[model samples]
Target: MSTLDTSALVIGVDFGTDSCRSLIVDTITGEQVASAVEFYPRWKAGMYCDPDRNVFRQHPQDYIDAFTLAVRNALAGVSDEVRANVRAMSIDTTGSTSVAVDRAGTPLALTEPFRDNPNAMFVLWKDHTAVREADEINTLARNWGGVDFTRYVGGVYSAEWFWANMLHVLRVDPAVRASVYSWVEHCDWMPALLTGTTAPDVMKRSRCAAGHKAMWHESFDGLPGEAFLVRLDPLLAGMRERLYRDTYTADTAAGTLTPQWADTLGLTTDVVVGVGAFDAHMGAVGAGIRPYSLVKVMGTSTCDILMAPAAEVDGRIVKGICGQVEGSVISGMTGMEAGQSAFGDVYAWFRQLLAWPLALLGDTPDAQSQRDGILHRILPELERQAALESPVDTGMVAIDWLNGRRTPFADQTLRGALFGLTLGSDAPKIYRALIEATAFGARAIVERFREEGIRIDEVIAVGGVAKKSPLNMQIVANVFGLDIRVAKSDQAVALGAAMFAAVAAGLHDSVESAQRHMGSGFETTYTPDPEATAIYDRLYRQYREYGALIERLSAAEAHPAPHSTELCTPN
Candidate 1:
């Protein structure tokens, strides 16, 4: 094989829930060196709180393991000569995936009440333990018009956001609150660790992570005034020291990799580590997406889109958007992101519970033969089932908040609902409902963006979900009422991180230039159907009424019955 001589060699490590993947990047050419993926063996036991519920988490050590394997594998592909030219190293990780570290920066062996507790361990982004807190934050933020600080966070907050989860811990588990000196996430903290910097050395933060997850703002005194904290939890007033000033984009070097970490990852100590950030943002860049252009990181959960603009929208924008921050995506633009927290998980759960061959199920199923994933042989039984249905004849409409809404209305307390279910309903009815729910969710976000005047000129889709399932895209097109561009790169997040490594190593002058040359292209596009759009418009109105009624009733009742839709419900 002919080899390409690159000016700079850098590594971009992407830490996912299952494992960490390292990509070796040629800064000059914007090419991927031999990349490596490491999976977590312990994932089976700890990762799933319930297959039906979209519950998940990952150990920090698993992250380190992923990084180690990815780096070593990349180096194995490098020639002895190119190895010497290697410069900076960096990592992109899932945000708000946090752990309690001691003064020495070690995560204590998880204690009782929290070991299995999703909140205490590493509350994965999809984790919903703080649903109650999220609801409260939403109420308060909406009450205040976000004047205090939440204005940056789309007028409302969710339990998944940094502040809500942090406050949830302090109120729920006082002991954990006390022992935890530093509440840090691997996305940001891992870079700090690699650089041999702790709170003192590098209390520094990633602008992307802080702006999106931690609510860090360079403009107004970094993450709302302390008054908001005191209002949430009087104890939180002291946490100002832990929060850091938002650093530049992830391409900027946070510091040099420390000797110990370098040795552990089998890399040279000279490697540069950039401030860590969420995988979704990097995926946008990796897919070669531009700001004002939205990129979807669709995997187990569908993180909807990210964009940046020069000026902020007037007044407030949407209800539950994560954030609109300067330099969050690329420098000098407001990076905006929102997500559908349960798409993939919902599909996965359907398959696991119903395992039937598609041919056997046909359009109709007897009551005796109803099962979830076990009944279907397709990768996603939901998609397969939905694809077989007539354009839109299934008498099922669902609220796609099974794992709760991630954008538009970031309420974790919200649950999934299936309306118009009758005895005639089958697995396909429920399956189609799930698809429509996600489509409606997307519409909610798109509408929110337009309302804010973000001017979502174009949309580029990436991720395993976008490639594997065409029906999902069609549903999304019909649902959101917009055509979306699918990313050609299957591994867009890893590619995005590599792009950053190139920039930090001086291979690329800026991200936009890198995106032009190195960015992956796209395939087919799915345009919205106006007929389906009109039908969906009527359905969405019903979905809104049903959701508002449920929310009001749930608020009134001490323990209202569960929502109509059931994921793992037996056939």
Candidate 2:
């Protein structure tokens, strides 16, 4: 360990769905010094995406460009003292956002031949184009006469994960497959890139991403066996050897920054870069997560993280979560993940649906400005108006599967549905229904943990929706019948990364120690309203009943019985 520098600052860069943000914080006080954000130009322009097909890809140059500008801009607002004294940095990214790479660990999208190819770019975590591959993986895991790799990942593999996305790309694009040497998660790649250790064999992979999304468990001796891969697909025959066998937690240092990166980010080569992890895992740490507490990272989607003592959860596998990986959150605790695939996204979709008229008033500058103003105000206005509506009087129930369900079962094929809507149902009423639907979805996750014997003593909320929407938070609290605390830091995910950086740089002995010295406490607590809770409880039962019916109908439609004239006949 190195000497502690109480004055030292650390940088935490969070690569999110739409943009990248950099936060600089004091190592000892945890005071946020400066911050900057840069939206990915390409992504913001809606390049390389087809929402109808659930295909989303981001160019690696977008990450490189965005983070570089964000960090430099963040540093520009601070003194040279802050810049020179920065001792370390760490990163968190949307997980299962991976891309094919060459032997040198250069993303294929960065190479000249594949520079413009969407297939060679980084697959965003929310992309669900790999549903078929995920189903195949799940089926093989269950029936294969060997180790069940997905057993630790809640007995289900999701289309949003590493293997499914990789397999999907390989099967669809021969050019990417031919040039690819291995695949690397976005979280793993950033640190490796900064530390100048981008070689496929040398880069340190994230235990959080690998364990949760890629099924890399110590008991499995790393990834699943070569036999399993070969059985799953001939294309994956030798992939196990190409991919990693070992993983490191975020508390460890990946390496020191290289001179080029140091110059690029206005830092010195002495600054250490810690191993990266998924945004939600690190966000939990930033939110002051403790054992038996659930931290919800609410943004475009919601990723719920809960850490427990390893000994208590040793042989227990919670059936339908993202995964349970040891040391993924706290250094010595077991981290379990669960989430709704759509939370804020559902609201965004509804807003878009309402704003369709804006598309017609286009091209003119005045029209454009008016359109932008309306778009900006739509959500806030909806939240306010919806808050005024009576929850029980709406008599509308909605299923929050607009982007598919992510927890209590990882099913992506299911679509969002609304019921009991009449002509009298207005925008505010429908919007209120959507909010309740998301809340109900969250309650389902909390109930799943309880059913599995995992005790959740408290709930913490962090992210855009949590901070901006009191109505959403209150509804969630009522739905769960539990109080919810909002984390104080607006940049909790980035702050969590800084905590890891502090430990990796030896400014702190462990993550817990760093957190105690630097944590931003809760800003507000939302308590369940008794009357609202009672109404929500009744609506929640209906939500579950409706969700089950939707799931059954979806499954039956996907794989109907051979001679099924049953649909034509009444029961």
Task: Give the winner by lDDT.
Answer: 2
Which stretches in model 2 have alpha-carbon errors above 4 Å? 1-3, 568-571
lDDT score, candidate 2, position 175: 93
Worst 10 residues of 1 by lDDT: 562-571
Instruction: Give residue 290's lDDT in candidate 1 (0 to 100).
Output: 65
TM, every model: 0.86, 0.98
lDDT of 1 by residue, 355-471 (tens): 544446665555335543344455565567678885357877787777767787676667787788788888877787877777777777877887766677687788777898898
Off by over 4 Å in 1: 1-5, 47-57, 109-120, 136-147, 312-318, 355-376, 380-382, 529-531, 558-571
Residue 7's lDDT within candidate 1 is 62
| Model 1, TM vs. native | 0.86
